[model samples]
Target chain A: MEGIYHDADLKDSPVSEKKTVVDSPDIAQTSDFSNLPINLQLDSEEKIRLYSQMVRIRRFEERSLRAYQQGHIGGFLHLYIGQEAVAVGSVSVMSEDDHVITAYRDHGHALAVGMDMDECMAELFGKRTGCSKGKGGSMHFFAPDKNFWGGHGIVGGQTPLGLGIAYALKHRKKKGACMCFMGDGATNQGPFYESLNLASLWGLPVVYIIENNGYSMGTAESRHSAGEPLARRGEAFDINWSVHQGHDLYEVRDAINNALVLAKESSSPSVLEIVTYRYRGHSVADPDQTYRSKEEIEEYKQNKDPINLFRDKLISEGVLSDEKANLLDQAAKDEAEASAEFAIASPFPEVSELMDDVYWETDNPDQKVSSGEMFFESSR
Target chain B: MPEITYREALNQALSEEISRDPNVVLMGEEVAQFKGSYKVSEGLLEKFGPDKIIDTPISEAAFSGLAVGAAMMGMRPVVEFMFWSFCYVAFDQIFNNAASIRYMSGGLINVPIVFRGPANGGTNVGATHSHTPENFAANTPGLKVICPSTPADAKGMMKAAIRDNDPVCVMENTILYNLKGEVPEEEDFIIPLGKARTVCQGNDLSIIAHGRSVMVALQVAETLQEKHGVSVEVLDLRSIRPLDLDAILDTVRKTNRVLLVEENKPFCGVDSQIAYLIQEHAFDHLDAPVKRVSAIDVPQAYSKALENFQIPNHDRVLAKAMELL
Candidate 1:
């Protein structure tokens, strides 16, 4: 390519060219996460939110996977299974004022951030009442009222946007931060590096959480990634870097809350890579067995499952009862069913609605870009 | 009205808008400290301070995407690309994020940002620097693609683009930056996008153009009227995305002959759409087939002669108009 479109020159060089801040040589389990700076144990209300949100995301994905099998979701259905603990954990530390953006596997992110389940289900069904009004299907869900930016389809595309939102927060002197979620696969993209560099240079209050789910689609991290661990790449930009155990909810929550504390106190960016794995394929179409062995998947599900680990920890610690937890899970499944019903009952969007909302309704009637301008009738 | 360079007109608009709203910001390579790669942002950094006028590290994708995020959060950011050709690096962010955010969010959110930069071919800046991507922006839905010809239109459109509730890509041409013209001195002056400006009136042929080519249309129209006694009506399409086809149809209906001109390649260029729309809506009004003069299909060459041959000049416009007549 003649222009900046070609990346041929960047082929030889891998992701990073600098060193990370390990402080200590050991990169092991290290310490008891229960003794974090911030209180990791959920309060009564926070406990309900944390537990219900995780269960809600789980049941929603299961129902959506079934819906996809039934030919309801026409396009790529990236189920967010095995990532519920990460979303729930990170979102738990976030306040309503904080802005959130993530990559395509965002069903969990939506539910975790309190998006209306009915709207989300309707969006998957491509109904008018969907969160995106049928303009964006499964891959794109946005709830500005809840401070959720979107489910960006382009990989690593939300990183810069997240950084920009953080810049806006810093500009306005607002006491809020932005959380950008991306997959390990997105680590290879150019914008990711650019965003990290600028976020650190400008000291923007944003935390980048890499849901490093072992694979960037079918390829393993060893094949695609140059570095052993993804979090260490942040050192190139002098960004604070750490790895969080995604399979455990307590660790994920504590780690994210710790990251946010550093972000707020310093007004700088930090990279937190959650070492997780997705149980499902990249999309609904993939068999998922092509890259990884069946035994590995079964082992992760049986032993290192995020929900199971959280449930066991809660049960053993007596923070929650198994029966009460079962009730919560059942309630979530029932809510998912009700929302699915609501989506089916909802009507398809009007054909005319396709033209509306393309541009905002302007104050000046004559100046409206799409309202009464061009081929359409200017109704303003 | 006072005559000023097209560059100063744009500068005045930015200074005015920055003063009008605190949320409005400027960010790009050398835009602040160096006063812009072109002098369009001269004295902006000093007047507005570093907080308002920011300089980036040539990270087009990240900075433009950042602007998109800022705009969504109720801040108006005006991002300047050194050249519009560099916009390709941020294509996903500009088209996917900036343009689609509002519609995809069900009107709940929007990005009120403007990506302004030179998108012309006559600068001899080589194939890499001299891309006319107005058609690219115009092709994408949810983006307001504005290209102005004169200082007045340049100043006016910049103001309107800053106020637009959508992502507006202001495709300025380096060739016209220093070109001086009579600009309105009114503080509240602004020319809304999608409205075409009449350069000169004629009865024989309508030469409709945009960007630097609009000057060619005006010169050709003036030459035809004085030398050959052929009166040509010239129309400057200030904005292309929300194209003012009504103005084009009105001109076609009056003159009964049309000659569309542009610096972009003939294949899928802005004029191609205009020519198609002309025949589609004003088919009966035409006395002859509507002709178009566009840049030759090639990666723009660096040599002066090659660059000149690539862009449509007044002679080419005149010849095309005569053929249409």
Candidate 2:
């Protein structure tokens, strides 16, 4: 296949050959996110809710992997196994008006943004109840009402889209911001740089959040990204920059909250490089722990499981009782199970509905007016 | 009524639209400070200020995508491309993003924007800067392509484009910018998209054309009537997409012959669609096979003489119409 052939050529190659020396390893180790001014003030309930959301995302993916193996789901499925905190924390900080756009690894992001569990599950199942009406599967779960733009398949495709959405918000004088989430791999695309320059030049209200999960599919971040501290690229375009621990949901939430505030109020562009890891293979079809060692996964799980770390913090600080935490975990598991059942029983999209909703009738004089009338003059 | 060049009429229309609607803004390289390379946006920056009349870096894809974003947010954005040839750099943003967003979002988003540029090959801009993309935008489903020859249509269509809900691509020829004509004084008169105008009425054959070709078609219409005693009906397809098939059908039914003229490559040019439509809808009415006069399937040459040879002109159109007759 063309994809495999391209992958083989890029096996040992870096995303870009430009090398720059940076004191990033020291910065990564000494990064005290708790000291950040934007850190969240959370009670027991809020902490548990964030944790539960991450657990739901995890549990959903585990079930989805089984379903894919059982041949219930088809097409490309990029799992969000290890990078739950990034989506949960960032999305948690956003308002109903704030928008989000992301790359292919999107099921977790969709669930985190308050999409109905059954709808997301139905999407993976390719049923009519899916958000995209079974047209876009796991990779394209979109809920525009929720302000989630898409689950884009193309690696760097969503960068320009995110910038555009932010520009729209600014142009309308709306107090809205767009969080454009992309992987470390997409940082190398031309549109990434192009989007950065335009976003900064125009001062578009957008926060570019790069989830540097140390890999593009199977390739390590070290093999990609020119500067280890990807946040520095923001300086070239005069965009405010920050690096946060992706595993620490609190830090991710705090960073996103501040960034959103800055984006919305100042109407300025910024970038946040969240260092994280993914536990599953790039897709369900690929064997896990092959290109990467099991030790690396174990290391991340033991020391940096965002949910576990946050749970321990809540317990030690007397914010959450162990029993209460256990109850929350069980509730999330139950929710995931219910969602799976609902999706399995849901109907596929109707055959007759193939050609509907293709284009708007703008040629009609009635539809062309912008008098703050009804969105569309629908008989229904 | 006023006598002004097609370019001046467009500039005036843009200025008027921006003044009329506070939400209307313009963005392009040299559009604001440099007053636009062709002076189409002259004195705009002084009147509208920098925020509305923006000067962007040499990033067509980025700026075009930004315009798409701006338009989707309910702001009417009129983006200048400097030249239509530069659109290739941002083709993805124009076709995929601006054009597809309304449809893909299930009509939740309306990309009410216009990408105006000097389209068609006539300025001896060479191969790199001399493409007429009527066929490209026409092929895209959700886009509205407008190519106006007269100053009246230029101003009216531009005003309509600014007020349109869907994405519209306005292709203005650089050569025709200085071609003077009478434009209505009223600001509210907007010619709707997809409506063809009878530039000249005759009974023998319809010389169907658009953009720079409209003039050639009219000139050929006169020649055919005078020399060959063949009356020619000319219809200027102002809007390429949602083409006025009724006008073409009416003319074809009367004349029983059609000659499609375009300056783009013959293989997939706008003329091909006109020919196809004539064959499909007006096949029975035709006394002879429908004829097409298109540019040679080669990159536009730099020399004026070479370009003249490649592009379809009045003589070529007249010959083609004669053949059909």
Candidate 3:
């Protein structure tokens, strides 16, 4: 807990014997969103829908954990179990053409963006039919049709790419905003702040969504973030920004929807700070229960479980029967299982494919045939 | 033809490119109002306005990425990094996004983007601002790296790069910006990317160079031919990445000797690549090993004397060429 504060300043990274720690016991509870005005906007059906989506993400993640353990998937896997509402609420309002680019934790966003469960599961299994043509594993999922750009691996790497997508959208006279999702840990990167300043100055249509899920992997936000409030960074750049409870799906949806509308109308960039939590460790491999305590996880689950709270609202308003909720959960499970099976049966890419997509084929006689397809076809 | 400085030629090229293509736009810090830091973007904001001539915050990563994205969405964006040293921050965007996007998108995306900037040791900018990054860009695939030494070449290449589908890195030497030369009057004339220019002709030995080294090699060639009684062929390798291997091979085949000059570091430098290329293609014609005149393997120092020693110069080119001959 004492080291969590120290861990924030990477200049002094704590040398723990264990490489990955799960929990941050000293993570300060900063806000009680239930009392905020943003909380009052959630109606029963909306709440239940949000809760159902969160549950879907959670259940899907649990199944994925088992699959990974059973050797069904390979490469790095980042789960969005604790940070479900960030995706569910923010993505709920985006149009088909609006862009969403994020770092590795992308399953929830993929689902939120309407990528078929089977396809997503297949992609994770490295099937050719998957979104990235089996080239990208779990951390590289992309659905261009859904305007979901990537599962960028590097921390704060997508910040500039997101800005570019927005610039492109604006340049082409497309009235869609780019929602760039990064973690609180990524904010430590100099590019994160630099991107904010540039995005705001250009009046680019971008929504920088910092899903402050406490840890930047194992390092807690309290330890990593400098004295400056992460959300208020937008104000320094004269960019419009607001901090809200990320666990409250209604709050997140309203904030993102409002931000998108403002960006569309004004052609300006905005920042939305979603104070959320991630229940699972940074990756599938880390237990994450070490840095933080069980009591804290139980506390958030008991007090601020977005899915449970929404389910209760739905039941109280008679919007859904317990039977319907259980059925949807079962359906999601079956979909994940079937996709995994399909992916398992699928074959890996052939050796010939290794040389494809390297260059654009323009006719340059000097170019060697061995260079493959990616070359300028200049007829000189 | 009009005699103008390299910087003026660059400015003229910008005006011509923007006027020629409605999609061509310029972005960089101090590109608007204040003209340009080096005045290469002077009078562009007034002509193109803020939308087309954007002055970005000092977020190289963000704007560079933005330029790549804009290029992907059917726009030709010309971005300026004030100094070549500052380009390190945006290498990811340049190498990963701008350069790799077309290939990554399965050729669905075309990054017709130009990253233009001043580079090389000059005016005591110290180690940070004095790197010649042609070799780095050349090392990256899917990028067209050009370092033109003449005003005419700068104008022609800048225009070509603005229109080229692949990402092009146009490295302008900071010290050469003020150097004057005759540029052709034709506004539409464009020297294609990946092509080299033979600056001078000879039969005794060939001098392969680019950017500032092109000027140095030309001076060295004139001195060697006139004063030292050596017939020197000077080849200005205008583009570094898609090297002009044909010219290099033919010249080396005729002369049977070569001196590769560059202002970058000796290790993995552009000069080494030229030497390697010549050896690979025209080894049978080579009468002697290709000699290299390059900056010493050390960072650029603040002291002018040390900095000069760090970069290959005219004397060094002449001396290296004489030894090879």
Candidate 4:
């Protein structure tokens, strides 16, 4: 009876203050790179590099969209058109030991981690020369050698995996962290909460980055989520939580850098919500007009485009000129076009190679350890 | 060779593997401090330390997925599910991430993780906790499923599962944990996956079974020999995914009359697949249609009497074998 709850003791009130905005207004207002924190500050050359990387992602996504329209590319293309800074900026702050894994919208992360444009495009074309050898199209890209774990297709599924990577690092006594990126909608998933509890309880070096791009597919965040500031859910698990605007590459770099430092130094996990916008529909197959309006899409494009914002910032700081900017943009466009050509020229995977990568034992015949029939169907 | 319980044999395998490889870690609910729910991981936490033998929160999805991530990074993690029925909560991680990560990455990544726990019904734990998922696990192409019926096979197959490069699901039985059998003490001793063991040789009929049902089939074999004067062969399928088709075909060719047995349900059960393979490959060799003795096709009941009739037992299997004779 002592442990039992009664209606008389229950009081109905709001869980927390309804603070909708997670982004820091101060960081958004700061324009001068010199005034930024020393850890957050970037050199002129590095700034230009980040700008160039964002441009490259935008152009590559645009090209892939074109291919999808032309019927050359099949399946869903979750283009990272508007949220380039989230990938480029976060990846730039990572040490060589650090790793990354993300949800379906993963092309931007793949390119940011230095995956070749040709292979990425070929993968979109479902060619053998692709990153996953045409086995994993659009949604799945992997470069383990580069510490980029995968382009996992399932929503909120990669959260525990990211935690595991960090768990492994700690288990092996390695100094690094894993940044697990997911959409705003992924917060509602059961595994994400479970991951949060474990990450905080074990003090694992993992940063769960929620890219709050205002919409979860067609549903707005206000409709899909109940409480304000999704990252605050980390507080329940005793994890450090914060939010910042993703449009500013500097802010994105700073917030992510701080979280990464907490992971490496303290072996603690943090949840940082990066408030951003996506111009394209959830996938190309999704018609943008269903849940959102044209004016909302145009508004984000004009005011908060990550690529244009960074390019203009670089130009304003005298780190890049108008002519140099145009040249870089043209170069990105050319590179994307050449990647499409490479994908076109690349051959599809041979039918013989269909079962090649299914198992390690099957791949290496001499070291083949398991007995009996591995595959149900025979290629011969 | 020392005779040991199925639980002790599994413990030996985990201990030997943990001592051999630094990357191997034992993690699950109550696995460390509690020494596992079934005491299969007894003395592991003390021998291997907290880092190697970890106790996780009752979050199967997180821990299962965490093991997968660690395996991707070259760490061999052996995760125990308190009960294999609990694995349904982490189905996405076990089925999608663990099973397909290797192939999806074009073989760039290998999930060298092992999920081991008892997956048996008839304890009257009700329908929720009583689920034999070996069939479901084997259905996935990227996964390897093994059901060890004896202490020796359990030890050898568990060691094999830990060392395997792909995700392996070891389906153990709670009732079989206390069963004693001779187990090899050698640290390097391992039975390769996907190989069938001929428990007994006969001329009349073959009773093909795996896991707990294999024990039932063996009992039926004994009764058939002494009571009915019928020669019954018992074949134990240790691994389900890389199924021993050659051994299956050979036994069917020898005995001529085949009777498949399993603890799984009749529909899409491991026996169903075996029955299909027999009819497909050795249909003409069969004296009669390959009959199956599987768990009754319904949700497992909680009542002792009904549950007894539900799971395949010695009497049910003996009756089926007599029909084949």
Candidate 5:
């Protein structure tokens, strides 16, 4: 297929008129993980678990995408296919007291926080058995029990909420941090900047993870943002910041672990810009062809695919044979398939349950402390 | 009971709630060292210390959203918007995040956050600073809006809002801040939300209002009885969302003539909903068409001469009441 980047097409293309895309700074490359701190270093079982978790997320995203294509899922379907390691690698370092919150593309974080595929998939299907009981849909998945605050839909809206989580942890004297994730596009939102100021001012324990997936929807990072590295904006607010390659799961884990430690130990906030790429469009509704060349997507997939990178690392370390890796991949595919089947079989929410969650008073009528009518009967 | 100003009543409520629940925090710009912009949070910092009474930068979106996030984790934040008109900058945080989070989460999370500050237009503060947003807040399903008309109600409703398990918007008035009324000294004196208070009972006309307009209704009720020889019943809608529909209907059924007065604009205002509710439920009882006296549909003028006429006053209520009679 002819890519979007052609010499003849470049002169007419409006996107080419903008600043030439600069290559990202090269990160220190090391295949060995022996020098990592004792706590940060992963055991063979932990390594396998992280690898399997990433595979599960990739499989779940693929299945969800298929469901969206098949017309089973409605509204936006923001797959976490290319950015699985960012969520999995970071969430692996959280303690029980820590919390996680992210923007619309939240399936990876939801799965990383140990949400079952059945409930997560059911939510995508808008079924009664879903995590939010079909009320939240895809961008609003929540598990307060798992310390996963939400799947907030707004671009940069969750930044303050993430700050609040850190505030609560500090107020309660709990030793944990909050991992607030947003896309490269969310960097320009006013709230994110405001949140950065407060997080630094109050010394709240929050690690803001900017998953720079190259494009903010169709706009490239250079076109969308003024800064070279988006994470450097934190310095203006006196926040510590660093950048890491997202596809290298080990690098991601190490970078996030350092930020989490800064948060938990010093009650300080840090910004981690994970240089990542997304194969799919911003949402499934978006067309990827208009934004970048197919070659750009292919290069990232072939060279820096997170799952393949981690799998190869584990294989080279003699943790598993190729047969064992294939079995794990097959198991993940089967689990994802089973989850989709469960979602298909699950019932949609009843019409009677429409007003149930609007108010806590309405839900618990027996312990209802509030008075007067909440819902207008005439409107119904 | 002790005679106290509306500001003092609000101050007492914050003091009591902060003492009652360790989770309850008072946060906003000028809430700590500088005191509240209206002095509603005066002496709170001295009483509760800096941790409980936090002063934030003039960043409404950040602080309001921070409070909402804290509330989700069971912190019970009482965010004071220096002026409720300033809430527009943080509308996405309050309207979208605070109001809809619980419902969107399927009851998995509760935002026990209170967004309180003066939200009236009679202070010559101009259109930018003066916004009566009870109607706007009430329009959202997940939020509960309260417009307390008296010192007693202010203290009671503020306590109730802090204790409530959902996001509550307490819309107050700067003009009413100095008005004195007898407020109860009880610690747990919470006037339940969605209930109405009939200030004075009569049968000739029903003067339904909320916030400072209720005071205008009371003064109008007196003049109607003295000069026009027409008796009037005043119904104060303390809470806007879980509206006191029973009281409104009862007053309408008893008076037979209804007149709605509010500080909001005429089009799609709080009175619009009340008038519909009366005509819908008690149309048979009403002898005349339900009348409404709201602020003139325009941005609040900064000039003192025109601003007074823009909001509902005693004369406007009386004139509208006479038309109904």
Candidate 6:
């Protein structure tokens, strides 16, 4: 051992070659949650909260799907059905002040961030009472007061904006990180790479989460990306990259908690890849059978349903009885039903609203006059 | 009032804004330790330090999109693209993210950011490098395209654009960076966005232009007034998006004729909008047909002779004004 001072000097020796460096999974599953550490342990209240949040998202998405099918919701309706564990688990770890932005599949993220279900439904219905005041449809939900930036429509569009928000938080000395969510499909985009590069270089406080739900709409990841894991893309940026089981709430929350700690404490960014499955068609219009099989869908619902897994975990751990879990699911359904009613009752925006909100306030005197005369603003 | 170049005026505006608001930061390629691509940010990095003055990598998408996000969180960022042509890479950020974010958010947040750089053609930077994209931005709703012609207006508009609640695009002309004019020494002096200024008064014909072409229009007006006794009126469009249609219409009414001098191509240009507006609003007032002097419908050539032919010039403006008269 003492003679092996340098690899250069032992170039011709029989035992000269360097030890083989092997790649292993960065995040290991502590699936045996019975022996969970104290700091990483989930309390009964926290578990209840996570279960309730996931259920709410699940119920809202199911209602939204019905609305889309019944022709109440317009435009594209991308449901976050089987991927509830990802949003609930990841967003539950975020501080109230921490910003969250995501791609078009935003119903789950919006509900997790405390956006009103009725307003979100109204937005889906293209009514004035919607989250975005009906200006943005199903794909865009914005709640800045709750630190939810938006649900961007373009693929991979929010990645750079996520970096910008982190920069602001750091610059403003705000004690929070931004949780930016994108799909597995977005990993291949230029904005994602560009944003990751800058976020890594600038030490931005961002938790970049790519929820790999197996497909981008109908195209499977294997065909699109040669079966490469999305987190592997973060390797080039030298960020703290990790992959976790998306179907497991415990693992997702724990991994996201670690990322949040890294970002908030020291302005470090972490790119996390979560393996999940989407239970719905990409949008309401998609037939969804072309890219995958019906058996696969039925199998996921039976075995890997996040809501079922978490409910069973709670029941098994004696945190809550089966009776209580059913109550929570019922409550979530009631709220979703109320949202549907409100969406129907909400009125469409008036014609005058078209000219409104284009600018903050048209400050110039020129806006006061018509083509005819020098009319004052009060008259106009 | 001190006379300064457009570059220095911009530098002063940025310097004063960063000093005034700690949240205001400047980021772009070669904008910090390297002064600036055009030296407009000279001495800013040394004065405010790296936290306020940032030199970004050549990833326009990242920096531009980051500025939009920063603006959302109440950080006013002034992102400089080395050239408007380079902004082609970040158009998604500019058009989709920055422009659409506010309306999408129900106007819950304000993107008080300024995306600025040299945007016009001259000095033989061929087709890819040359663009007068004010119309492209103005066509979209959420963006305010400010094209300042003089050093004073550059200073005023730079400050105002930084302070505006919406994302304002400051389209600086490359040819006019060295041109000197009187800039106000007042710290808070600002020319609000969407206000057009009449540089010269006349009753014969109104020659309207923006950016560096305004200088050409001024020259043409002076030549017409001095040599031809044409009484040419010059209207400088300070901001293109929220176009001051009243000012243009008033000038057209007074002059009874108009000659639009645009440095952009003839088709679907800023001039096209103004031409349609005049015909729509001031048709009765117009005695003769409204004429336009625009760059030919071709990519800007690198050759000097071709570049001169492509962009609208004083001679072209004079010819257009004569034709309108």
> What's the TM-score of each model vs. the native?
0.94, 0.88, 0.86, 0.95, 0.95, 0.93
Q: Order the candidates by lDDT, highest first — what do you get? A: 4, 5, 1, 6, 2, 3
What is the RMSD, in Å, between candidate 5 and the native fold over all Cα? Answer: 5.5
List candidate 1 stretches off by more than 4 Å.
Answer: A1-31, A362-380
lDDT of 3 by residue, A339-361 (tens): 77777787776765543544443
lDDT per prediction?
Answer: 0.84, 0.80, 0.76, 0.89, 0.88, 0.84
What shift in Å separates residue A239 of candidate 3 from its native position after superposition? 3.6
Encode model 4's per-residue lDDT on A227-306: one tens digit a residue. Answer: 88999999999999998888888888888999999999999999999999888889988898889888877766655777
- Residue A288 of model 3: what lDDT? 71
Task: Give me the overall lDDT of model 1.
Answer: 0.84
Q: Worst 10-residue stretch by lDDT in candidate 1 chain A? A: A5-14
Among the numbered candidates, top lDDT falls to: 4
Candidate closest to the true structure, highest DockQ: 4
- What range of 10 consecutive residues in model 2 chain A has the weakest lDDT sum? A2-11
True contacts kept of 2: 0.27
Regions of candidate 2 where Cα sits further than 4 Å from its true position: A1-40, A66-72, A95-97, A125-128, A135-137, A169-175, A264-267, A285-295, A320-326, A344-355, A362-380
List, residue by residue over A1-380, the lDDT tens digit for candidate 1.
11121101111111132122142233234345645645445664566567678778878877777777677767888988877889998988887668899989999999888887899999999999999998888889999889999989999999999999999999999878999999999999999999999999999999999999899999999999997689899999999999877877778888888778777888988999998878888997887888999887775665566676566556555666666777787888799889888988999999878776677745234755442144323332
- In terms of lDDT, the poorest run of 10 residues in model 6 chain B is B316-325
Docking quality band of candidate 3, CAPRI definitions: acceptable
> Candidate 5 residues A1-380, lDDT tens each?
21222111101112224222133233225444435773246788898899899888888888888888788999998877778889998988878878999998999999999999999999999999999999999999999999998999888999999999899888888888999999999999999999999999999999999999989989999899997799999999999999888987887888898899899989999999998988788888888899799898876665567777677767767885577777787898799999999999999999999998988888888987778878776962
DockQ of all models, two decimals each: 0.55, 0.30, 0.29, 0.79, 0.78, 0.43
Native interface contact recovery, all models: 0.62, 0.27, 0.33, 0.80, 0.70, 0.58
Q: For model 3, state the Cα shift of residue B50 in Å.
A: 1.7
Candidate 3 recovers what fraction of true contacts? 0.33
Comparing 2 and 6 on TM-score, the stronger one: 6
lDDT per residue for candidate 3 within B1-325, as digits (tens), equals: 6799999989989999899888899999899988989999999999889888998888788788778766756788999999878889987788877766554444445677899999878577788888888888877777878898888888988887776766889999878889999998797878876677788889898888888888788888889878978888888888876666677778889889888888888898877767766677677998998898888788788898887766777776767776886
lDDT of 5 by residue, B1-325 (tens): 7899999999999999999999999999898999988999999999999899999988888899899889889999999998999999999899999988987888899998999999999888899998999899989999999999889999999999999988999999998999999999998899989999999999899888999999899999889889989899998989998987888889989989999999999999988988888889998998999999999999999998998888898887788888887
